[model samples]
Target: MATLLLIEDDLMVRATLRQILERAGHVVIEADHGGEGLSKLEQQHIDLMITDIIMPEKEGIETIIEARRRHPQLPIMAISGGGRTRNMDFLEVARQAGADSTMAKPLRAQQLVDEIDQLLRA
Candidate 1:
């Protein structure tokens, strides 16, 4: 199982996602904001990252960019609950910044797992 970092500013989302990942056998480190996420990266052995695009302290794009600088080979999956429209814009920004993949908000746990696996293999 991959050591994953889940970065989301929403309390509910963070809790739910943490539960899902832990249940799936992933070693997960949870962070409620980008700043905390960055700190965790500096302190953990992360294999992949799943981050919410919109966040406090630092946005997902900024986080991804910084992460790329620190660990360019790290795979990142950026997600956002931007309704529908313009959501792609956020995803695109994350991709350009550093994320290897992106997913829409309300992420299906199965899909998240699939993407994480795919990124790890890639």
Candidate 2:
């Protein structure tokens, strides 16, 4: 099992994700925003990161870039419900910013775990 950093602004969504990850045997560390998530990353050993794209303090794109710069070997997964705006696709942006994988919100539990397993294996 991996120790994962789960960065999301929504309380309910974070809780749900925590439950899912914990049930799947991963230790979940939560952060309400990317800034906090980065802080946690600095203080601990995080095996993976699952971040929401449209967070408040620091958004996912910036977070992914900085995290990649700091921890080039760390695996990152970006997730969002609002994947696209008027002319931008945030998930695609996340990929360019250094996310190892991306998934839309309202994520399927099994698929989420499966993707995580693949990322961990890699």
Best by lDDT: 2
Q: What shift in Å separates residue 118 of candidate 1 from its native position after superposition?
A: 1.1
Off by over 4 Å in 2: 83-88
**What local distance difference test score does each model get?**
0.87, 0.94
Task: Find the candidate with the highest TM-score and give its number.
Answer: 2
User: lDDT of candidate 1 vs native?
Assistant: 0.87
Clashing pairs in 2: none
lDDT of 1 by residue, 12-83 (tens): 988888888888888989998888999999997999988999887888999999988999888888998873
What lDDT, from 0 to 1, does candidate 2 have?
0.94
RMSD in angstroms between candidate 2 and the native structure over all alpha carbons: 1.6
